[model samples]
Target chain A: MNLSLTLTINGEQREIVLDDPRVTLLDLLRERLHLTGAKKGCDRGQCGACTILVDGQRINSCLALAISYDGSAITTIEGLAENGALHPVQQAFIDHDGFQCGFCTPGQIMSAVGLIAEAQADGDAERIREAMSGNICRCGAYQGITEAVLDAQAKISTGKERDAA
Target chain B: MNRFEYVRPTSIAEAVAAAGEPGSAYLGAGTNLLDLMKGGVTQPSRLVDLTHLPDLGQIEQLPDGSTRIGALVKNAALAHDPAFAEAFPAVAEALLSGASAQLRNAATVGGNLMQRTRCAYFTDPASACNKRAPGSGCDAIGGENRAHAVLGWSDHCIAVHPSDFCVALTALGAIVEIEGPAGRREVAMTDFYLLPGDTPEKETVLDAGEMIVAVRLPAEAAAFAGNQRYLKGRERTSYAFALASAAAALKIENGLIVEARLALGGVATKPWRVQAAEAVLAGAAPGKEAFEKAAEVAFAEAKPSGDNAYKIALGKRVLARALMMAAAGTPERMPALPASPFAPLPEGVVNV
Candidate 1:
């Protein structure tokens, strides 16, 4: 049976039709919408290569069914940057050399952004490491990745305070 | 993955009715179900999505001071919830230590409880797994059985349940509330999981259409929450399945143990609760000797395979350590040890 779903992707409403009910959000984004920022490493939940933000919560999109999130808001890595400026997390990743092969970069950055949004990436290095453990970089760049997440968290928190002021 | 029909029901009655249909599976977070579907292990003709049910994602305190956690409440939210953490710290810690933050964000409490074992044989469609395909022989029995169960495992199946949250819930004496086409009912957490006896395919006592509504923590368990601890020993520091884990809670008065609740995971086919061990700790002082005695009684019935015999000793040590730690009120001090004796040593490393 063909299913039609309407999802708010990157703050914009997008409607899509699926011929197979087993299509995952990761497949819908990469194959249908051509939003290939989310990579499919294992096609299973074990690898965090398909991490995305669903209603501001970090989840593995490869395991999430597209139809289950019909009316939810999704934020992929492509949606992080706005107005021709890189998001703080993206810039922090580049500045800290958080990646080597860059295959897991998008997922790492998206998870980092969601962590900050969830207020889970506190200033503690151990906390940031544990939170970012979902996204694995085979290049062994975890030290740099942990550093980038902490740096981006500080930037995000400061920006929020400034906006409030 | 199979092409299945998906229906999102707006009400519990409709959801339960749809689930009662032939070859229908309830989809909570789809973390475990989707993975199994991708592995070609499970093929459901229909998926009844429970996410759309109203008021199924809430976490509230009942009038009896017990907490009622909805079936759809995400694992990450339960771990970070201030009230839940305050009432049951070990439950929060166990949830946090199970999966990554990303998976936990999508996984729900009900789904976590219903997750299947991570046995390689069960996941591989070609392997002979009695749990996956009835009448088939178990590959883990004669194959690589390093991760097989050491307790409550039948010859038909040696797989262990891969849930850390259930172990803690069993120790805390939680109750699982279920809703179905028949009526509403409650099942004790200890009875929620089933041993892998001759009927390894039948995991839980729930009927086909029965759905878990919420998990209730009794108000009496609150008194021992501060002294509870969930300790998991894995191959790595994080993101790995437990090798031998323990969930322990001690009620100590005047430096003597008045009551104790102990359950084990990662080494049993189900959440292994040992009342004999608890009986041993009833009037004894909280120390290493008492903990050792209790651990001995807990593992007196353990039957391990050839490759997994090390788990027998490891499970004992883990349970003893968890009991002592819970009694000492130091749950966060999980000390790291060197490589296991069973593991191959490094090239240049010398063993004493």
Candidate 2:
């Protein structure tokens, strides 16, 4: 069954006409919208490789049906940067050496961004590790990833404080 | 994945009517259902999207101080809600312990209850799984049956329900409210999930076209809100299914156990409640001996398979430790058990 869905992707509203109801959000992003930043690692919800923010919450895009999210705003790794400046999380990934092969970097950055927005972890390394447990990096770069999330959280918090001031 | 028709229903009636159609399934978060569909495990002809239904995404306190969590309430939201966490800490912990943060954000309460087993054999359509295809034979009975059920297993299927939240709900005596073509009805959480009896295919007691509206937690459970613990034993600290888990709540007055509620997960075909275990603890002193006895009673009927005999001992220790932790009022400090004995499987092999 074909369904028409209008999704606000990366702050831009895009109308999608799906011929199949089974297409996942990950597929819609990569195949239709050409937002290839979200990689498909497991194609299942087990791996967080397809993590994206839907309405400011991190979720596995591979498991989310594109048709089910009609009016939802989706934020992918590509959406993290604004005005040609890297998001704090994306910058922290580079500063902390958070990626070895970089296959899972987009997912990791997206998850970290979503976690910070949720105000979890609160700059605790253990809490950040637990919060980011869903996104796996088989390259054994967890130490760097943890440091990056913690660093990014601090930067984001400082940025928020400056904005409030 | 099979091609299916999709219908977005804005009301409970529309959802029920759409779901009443032949071979229709309600799509909440699609966390598990989509995975199953991608694996060709389940092929529903139509999907009735229930996300459009208004007023079904709330977590509210009933007038009597009971908690009414709508079926569409996300797991992460419920786990982090101040009132819900204060009222049911163990349940909140259980929900948090399950899946990844990303999954919990997308997963819904009703979807968690309706999730399918994580049995490797059941998920692998190539394998013979009675739950997947009736009379196809269960390969897990003799093939890598480590994660298979030890408590409730018929000759047909030994798969276990993998919801950690449901285990806590069973321990809390939660009630499931359902609305269907036959009107509204309520079923205790303990009775909501069915055992793999002869028909392993039929998992829940919800009749055709019945949709879970909400799960109502009784006000009495709030009394023991501070005295509950959910101990999940898995291969990893997170993002892994439980090998054996215990959800325990105790009411102790002056060192004497006044009431006890206990349920086991990941070791049974369903969220298993052992009234016998609770009975053993009731009226007894809160000590190691009483806790050990309760654990024994909890696993008295466990019939383990070849690779999963360790679960018997593991389940006993987990239950005993959970009881002791609940009694000590240190549920928050309850540590994760040692790595699962079933872990470190061969490469490319997933835990069933």
Candidate 3:
């Protein structure tokens, strides 16, 4: 059976028809949508290398089926930069050197962004750490990543919502 | 992912009916299911997504002073909800302890409850596993038993159920509400999950064609407000399955324990509840010795498998520490437990 779903991605309403269950949201994003920022590292949920935002929540797109997410709003790394300006968390990653090989950068940034949003909504650092700990970077860039997230949090917490916009 | 049918049902009854087929599973947040399908671990013939169903995504308060959390509620949402945090702190803490923020955002309540074991044998098709393929034989019994269960394990299988949040739900007297072809029935959370017993393949009491509509946690009066704690000893600070963990609730009045509830995970095949320990600490002082005695009560019936005896000791520590932490809660703050003696961090407990 086939199903057609309409969703908002990168501020554009897009309709996709899915039937073959083999195609995941990750597959659609990489192979169909042509947004390859969310990489496929360990296709297993063990690695958060394919993280993205589903209605502003960080999720492993590789672990999300395209057909299941028919009408949900999605945001990817490509959507993080508006008017060529990187999102605060992404900028903080650049400033803190949060990545080495950069394979897990997109997922890390997406998870970090979610953590930062959560912290601003009243979560602490330990809570944020627990939340962001799913995206693992084998290059051992955790310290820098945590620092980047904390750094971005400090700015976002005290800054204006317009920055997020 | 093999080609299959997909449906987005709008109500619990519809979703339950759709999922009643031979190889059909309801899609919650798709965190575990999508991974399994992609990794070739689970290949369902159809997926009936429940997220689009409005009622399944809500968390409601029952008139009987219980919390009804929809199956489609995201793990992140459940852990952050104020009412749930107060009534079931162990649940929030357990979810926080299990996956990283990113995964939790995608993980749903039902999917979290129904996640498959992380056993290498069950995942690796080449490796024989009776759970994945009944009568194929479990290679994990003797072959790499490190991450396998210590208690409730038989020669047929040693894989552990991998849900940190479930242990807390078990201790807190939660209930599973399922809508099946037979009709709606609420199973106590403690009984919803069963030990591997002789059938390692059957994990829960829910039958086929049944959909978990919601999980409800009942309310209880408190001694200075009942406190809950979830203590986990995993491979590291993040993103690893628990090695041995405890979910405990304690009601202490004037340094005397009035009521206690304890559940252990990782060491057992199911969310292992300890009624004996709960009884042992019912009237004792809320202190280390009281917790130690309670731990003894729970471990008395435990049978550790080969190479996993360490879990028996670790499970005791987790219980004792969680007990103390819950007992230590003040009128203001729910206390934090001591760190576990086992730290497999900086070292690979399971391949990252």
Candidate 4:
């Protein structure tokens, strides 16, 4: 039973024919589309290594079936750059050294982007830390991650302010 | 995960009809369902995807002042909704407290209500869990169960329902709207979850082919908006399930409690609501004395099912502390750590 679906992934429209209904969104991105930036640390939902954006909201892609997300716009780690320039969050992570092993960096950056867009972090360090609790960095890079999120949020908000002005 | 037929229903009637199949299951967000499926705990023949259905993704304020939250509404969306947060602060706090931001963004309200136990025995296919395989046996009773249920647990099963949102909803007297083969009906949140009696597999009051359409919070439940809190005690500061938790709401008039609602989580098979404890708090001054008495009444029938005797004592303290926080009044803004015990107490509020 082949189920056909279309996904706007990383600003590209990709048509997919899924032969298995059990294929998760993470597997589809990493295996079929070769979007290996989104790592699969834990196939279970407990780990946020497979976090991605579906219609601008952050979700654990490992637990989401590909067939269930038909026609939805998805954004992964590969989508975070513009014109080969790093996204603010990605730049901020590099500036603050937000990772060590880097296995969880892609998910961390994607989740940070989603968090900043949600605007619930309010540029507060504690709020950012709480919000990013889902994306675990086993290397204990949370201090840098939190700092990076705060910095990126400030940069984004200032950019918005500049745009409005 | 086992392969299954995926059915996307455009209408509630269609979804219900498709779910009427012998081995069909209603799939909402698939946060819990897919996880359980991958773990080999449950294998359904077909999944009726309910995310496509219209009108189940809205949060509506009815003319009668009650709020109707769609079953498909995401947890984060509902919690961040200013009107909902202002009206049902405790519920919002509870929602924010459970899981991480990513999970909250994908997990639906109905999925949260329908989530199974976090019991290791239940999730592991090798273990003999009565809740997972009915009449098989319960390994949790004699296993490592420091996190097991302490109230309303039977010999058949001792797994606690792991939802902080349900804790607050049980206290607010939320009503679950259901669509089933027989037609539409409503069940109070307090009665929606069933205790693990002899039929441990039957977790909720929902029958076969029934789907949760929406959950309604009556207008009266908003009365405690000013003085309500959901406090969770966990091993970690964040992103962990509760060791024990309590939701406390009070309506104070002339320095006396007119009505109080209290419920416990992580300590029972269901969100444990003790009306007798509320009766103890009624007309009493919102003080440490009254709160302590209420906590005692709340845990009157609680007994540890395993090595969880500490949960009963911890649960009582959580209830008392939550009552104190509620008496201190809801915060002007949500705490940085929404429901964590480490969140700074409101001014003039002392520790329990």
Candidate 5:
């Protein structure tokens, strides 16, 4: 059975047709829409390569079925940059070398962005670190990723910019 | 993943009715169920997405001074709740120490409780895992079982229950308030997850149609909480499966061990409670010797495999040290040494 889902992606309102109940939002974005910034490392939820934001909270899009999320506003790595400008979290990652091969960078940056926003709203470093723990880098670049989160917090605190493939 | 009918039920009755079907499943937080589906492990005929059901998404206080946590309450929210932190701090610590923050944010309490094994063999379709395919046989029994259970494992399975939150909750005397197709009933934390005896397929005793509505934990257990600690031993420092873990909750009255609760994870198929050990130290004065003896009692029934024999000793050492650290609470006490995941499993890889 097919389900029609209307939602926002990168600030644009779009409607998606879920051909199968098993097709996830991440699958819909990468396979159908061809927005492949979110990599599928494990397909399972163990890896955080498919992290995205729905209403400003980080969720593993692989586990979120497309039809279930029927009218909610969604955001992916493709949505982080607007009008040729990058989100502070993405920029901080670039500056801090948060990723190496960068396969997991988009998901990492997305998780960091959500975490930093929560931190700004009175979340402590421990809380931020605890929250961002799901996103893993096989390159063992956690030190850099955490530093970039702090850096992003600093830049977002002031006003600065940084993104690219 | 197999094609299934989907229904985003907005109310509990609708959701329950949808899940009441023969092969219907409740997708709470969709953490484990979806993962299993993609791997072709579980292919339910229908998925009743319960995220939209408002009835199962609340956290409130009961008249008995206990807290009722909705099944849909995200792990992150439950971990950070003021009442959870203050009342069931061990549970809070367990939740925090569980999957990283992002996972906890999206993972619901019910989902976390129902998460499947992280065993590589189980996830790998070709591998022989009895839990995944009953009567297929357990490869971990004689294979690479460094991460497998060291206690309460039968011949059929040795896989461990992966939640750190359940370990502490087991010790805190938490209860599961559930609603099945028939009616609503409550289960204590101890009886929730079953050990892998002859039937590895039977994980929980709950009826198939029964869905967990809320988890109610005694608010008083938080009062007994003092210097709670959750120590995990993993291959890597962060975001890896546990080799062995210890959860300690101790109370110091009159400079002695008035009450204590200890549970082990990653080393057992169930959240193992050492009540005998607790009974040993119930009135005994706090000291290294008493703690060591009590720790030994906890591991008394440890039947280890080839790769985890040292875990018997390692669990005792860490449990003793963690209990000591928890009891002392002052800076004068020295921290326990990190345990090693060094033991190797036996030679033959058994497949039923």
Candidate 6:
């Protein structure tokens, strides 16, 4: 059965027509919308390759039905950079060599963004590692990933402090 | 995943009616449901989406001092809720310790309670599982069953319920509010999950068409907030299911245990509450002697179903350490590893 869904993807309103109810948000983004930036690594939600922000919270898009997320705002890895400048998290991932195969980097970066927004870690390396435990790096880049998240969180907090001052 | 008819109902009545059908399933965040579907474990003909329903997402403080948590409240939201955490620290810690950050962000309180066993045999369609298919032989009995149930297991099934939150809820005496075609009703958290008897397929007390609306924590359940701990023993420090877990809560007065609440998880078909153990702790001082005695009573009826005899011993240690940690008092802040054994504990206390 065909279903209609309206998603504010990457800060842009895109009314999508779903030909099937079985289409996951990850499938809808990669297959139909051609937004393959959100990789589909273990489509069963075991790996966080398809992680994305839904209403400012990180979730496994592979397990989410596109029809269920209608009228919700979503953010993907593609939206991290603005006007030719990479988001701090994206830059930090590169600076810290957060991935070997770059397969789980998009998910790691998106999860990092969502984690930073939650602000529960407070830039603690242990807390960042714990909070980002959802995303797995098969290439064994957890150390770099943890360092990247810590650096990015420190930068974001320092920037906020400067703005407040 | 099979293509199913998706229907979004805005009201509880409508959702209940829609899910009453034989092949209908209620969709929460689909964190677990979709995984099962993708694995070809469960294929419902119709999905009744419950995400859009209003009034099922609020966390309210009732005038009677009880806290009514809506079933739709996301796990992350509930865990991060400062007031809720302060009132039910172990429950918050259990929720944080479960699954992963991404799953918790999307998973709901009700969905967590409804999650199925992580047993490989149950998920693999080729394997004969009595829990998955009634009357089918249980492959887990002779198969690799190191992580199977120890507390409650029949010849038919040995799968354990993989929920850390339910363990803490059972210990704290949480009440589950249900709405169904018949009417609204409440069931104690301890009684909500059914043990695997001859009919392992019947996992819960909920009849067809009944839905969990909210979970209520009695005002008195908050009394143990001063001394509560949920400790989980997992294969990994994070993002792993529990091998054995314990939720321990004590109400101590004048160096004596006024009351105690204890429950075991990842070692049973349900959140196994040991009221007998609690009775042993009453009027006794909180210390190694009493905790060890209670741990023995807690595992008095436990027996391994398969190659999981080690779980019985591991479970005993988990409960004892959890009680010791609870007696030491809850930490001011959530541990960095939440419920993991690696989290920093009281001085002179060893990891289980």
- What ranges in model 6 sit over 4 Å off? B348-352
Model 2 misplaced stretches (Cα beyond 4 Å) = B330-352
Residue B134 in model 3: lDDT: 82
How would you encode candidate 1's per-residue C-alpha lDDT over A1-165 as one tens digit per residue? 678989999999998888888889999999999999999998897779999999999899999999998899999999989998999999999999999999999999999988888775468777677677788899999999988988889988999999999
For model 1, the stretches where C-alpha displacement exceeds 4 angstroms are B330-352
Residue-level lDDT for A19 in candidate 6: 82
CA displacement after TM-score superposition, residue A34 of candidate 5 (Å):
3.2
Supply the TM-score for candidate 6. 0.99
lDDT of 5 by residue, B223-245 (tens): 66555666666766455666777
DockQ of 3: 0.65
TM-score of chain A of each: 0.97, 0.98, 0.90, 0.98, 0.89, 0.97
Scoring only the second chain, what is candidate 2's TM-score? 0.94
Comparison by lDDT, 3 against 6, better one: 6
Error of 5 at A136 (Å): 3.4
Kindly give the stretch of ten consecutive residues in candidate 3 chain A with the minimal lDDT sum: A119-128
* Candidate 3 residue spans exceeding 4 A from truth: A120-128, A161-165, B221-225, B330-352
> Order of candidates by TM-score, top first?
4, 6, 2, 1, 3, 5
- Residue-level lDDT of model 6, residues B227-318, one tens digit each, is 99999999999999999999999999999999999999999999999999999999998888888899999999999888999998999999
TM, every model: 0.95, 0.95, 0.92, 0.99, 0.89, 0.99
Tens-digit per-residue lDDT, B51-94, candidate 4 = 98999999999999999999999999999999999999999999
Residue range with the least summed lDDT across 10 consecutive positions in model 3 chain B: B343-352
Candidate 3: global Cα-lDDT? 0.78
Positional deviation of residue B269's Cα in model 1 after best superposition, in angstroms: 0.4
Model number 5 iRMSD: 4.0
